[model samples]
Target: MAIMDLSSLNNLNLDAGSIFLLAITICAFLIPVVVILPPVGLQKGDALLQTHTKAGVEGARSNLKNQFSAEEHAPADGKPPRVHSLVVYPVKSCRGIELARSRVLPSGLQFDRLFMFAQLKSPFPVAVDSTDAEKSQHKWEFVTQRQFSRLANVTVDLWLPDEMKLRKQSMRSDEAFLILRFPWKEDGWRGLFATIAAKLGRGRAAEPEIEVLLPVDFPSAAEIKEKGYTFENVKIWKETINALNMENELPDELRRYLGVSNKLALFRVDPEQLREVYRCAPSEEEAGYQPVTGFQDAYPLHLMNLSSVQKFSSEVPKDDDLKELDVLRFRPNIILSGAPAYDEETWKQIRLKPGSSSLYNDVSFHVSCRTVRCKMPNVDQESGLRHPREPDKSLRAQRAVDEGAPLMGCLGMQLTPLFDPSLGEDRAAWIAVGMTIDVEERGNHVYIKQ
Candidate 1:
């Protein structure tokens, strides 16, 4: 294939290096490298530099169709999305911990909810762990799932003391200690010999399983709250907030299996004390930072939309005391995937990106509202039992259309963690579980979540 002899190409001296090598071999195989610039009055040693290279490829394709038509009038399809799952809860409407990766704190995950259940303050029988030093002047009222739906089968598991020499250690939840394991059922014959020795797997203790360890307190001195804490303000809804009780020691068989009387009292949320999401931002020192929380009733990350929770599991009401319904009854602490169910209410802010703990990449979060739907998703975190009227009666017949949030049923949102590097913040951005989201959308509206 070596010809080059068109009559000696007119004695071949077409200089300017053979017309810029024949205009880059006929426009570098045709266009698109920002149309090889050099237009608006062409210059590269012009001899009509190949006739202004088609006016620099139609001005780089009309400036790439006006910047993708301004990203099709932006609001994010900037494309990213994926983090499928990673729950936390660690006590406060209990039973949570599902992680293939986690530690994105600020307030969510990383020992979320911190530890709750207060109410033992007024009148009612109160006497299970009654250390009668005049019952430390009784007064502790938080208790949740609206009002104890067995507080969702309470379960918490955290370990620290040198396993793998502190695998990626992160501290300050008062330095580790939360074991708690419970569940007991007995009626007769010591629950019938602990249910016939459980088919011989050695099931004793009248078959209810126990395990406790507790001790993780740190509200920090001032005499431990001027003398062994009992502070407690706790309301969480109209946000009374501020808690401390829990001098650590709860076990009279977990106050008769959480019926709560024997001096249970464990509330905790006071370190660095900020709690002001001021109802969707603009308070924690005017949003410069600080949305602190512990017994999370409101904000510190939630985000759920596994296809709008499998389409709200066929919109509830499916017979036999309502079963098939667990996206952990809307508890969510990050669980997105692809999009469109309720299309994550239309995002507002998301970033994430980093799946295997290099400490986590990007990591953002702003979505501050729409979690509304209370009645604590009708309880049932594995039979803590509550389902009286499902999904708030099918979310008041099709998501109550938000009249500024009446009879709520919103489906996941609420996040705050703006920065973290272990809170001193210089951006560590951590977040796990498949991680990779981007989203933004500021207009498809969604706010109301008092």
Candidate 2:
């Protein structure tokens, strides 16, 4: 029987070497597919799942979660909470207006930060005589800290028409105000602060007058007020102007804006205090883990609790003359009103507009992470405006504890909107927060199923 079986095997013409070669060939193709394909599918699946999960979670968390267990479902203070205050900056970096209602686009707020000034130097005779050249040069010049710290103090009224006009307030002489034609003829058009100085032969001069730019066709506040484009408050303008002024002293490579973001779009409010929970481990130490390269920039949304602001205000000294809490220092995108004490950090999700209307036509924003506070908040927004002897200790104390540290009380959310390139400068963006996601906290840096 054994001899017969051996004879049958030999007749089949299959050897151990042949079998092994076939197995190796099969693995070469299949192993890579097995290793690489699932991850791609997992990433796509995770993103989609996260978006839906966040949306559902936002509604539930806000309604169910509260700092005081007894107040979970009850409305705090008998008033509905405000989820976000949309702000738009018409110029790139100047200032912003808090809008009760705003038009949204894929980039962010519509008609926000669309125009910018480019600086150029020229001396053609015809160029010098043309009105266009004069207007172009005026658009380019800006004031910086290097020339005068008070350059930020200067404010201008921007009037848009066939010709743009910049009316500057008098600095040395209160009654002697100056009006300069933006885009001065001698200097090239498109440049912001630089063009203004170059045209007036004050390119080398320290502390030249500040200039403003307006769209040639857009109506003024009076004309647009009836059309629902009325001008509201503009207190945050100085903060951005100060940031730009400080950047001028730094190198060009370090400069984020070359007076381009004159129309400031957003301002935030960050928690003054935070506690560190844990530091992330290296990627190689864990199985199936990849380190996040931009971990430093991890925050997805910034949330400000209205109650927390009130709590801080209660601690102010009786002798101190503190005004409203300045929102510009923190630079948050969304400001939440009527939240329970320290409840923002516990929020897993936040919906911008619930059932009434979509955040932007057919889009919505999801809250994802906790916004961490930075050292920039320490700078007093009203330092130059207030008296020198005034005790500005609250901001200083807040900064001492918050510099380069994470704040625990605030929450952030990741906004996932369908990409639409035609939406122009209305791209949806995220804000900073300090907390780590559970998936990120565990060995799996890659997003995983909750």
Each candidate structure's TM-score, on Cα atoms with residue i matched to residue i, is 0.28, 0.35
Clashes of 2: 57
Cα lDDT tens digits for candidate 2, 411-448: 22222222234544445433211111111121111111
lDDT (tens digit, per residue) of candidate 1 on 85-107: 67777667776666656666566
> Candidate 1 — which residues are off by over 4 angstroms?
1-91, 94-112, 118-148, 152-220, 230-258, 269-304, 311-317, 323-330, 335-361, 364-384, 387-450
As a whole number from 0 to 100, the lDDT of residue 15 in candidate 1 is 74
Give the Cα lDDT of each candidate: 0.61, 0.33
Instruction: Choose the strongest candidate by TM-score.
Output: 2
Candidate 2 ranges with C-alpha deviation above 4 Å = 1-80, 90-93, 111-210, 214-303, 316-323, 354-363, 378-450
True lDDT of residue 382, candidate 2: 34
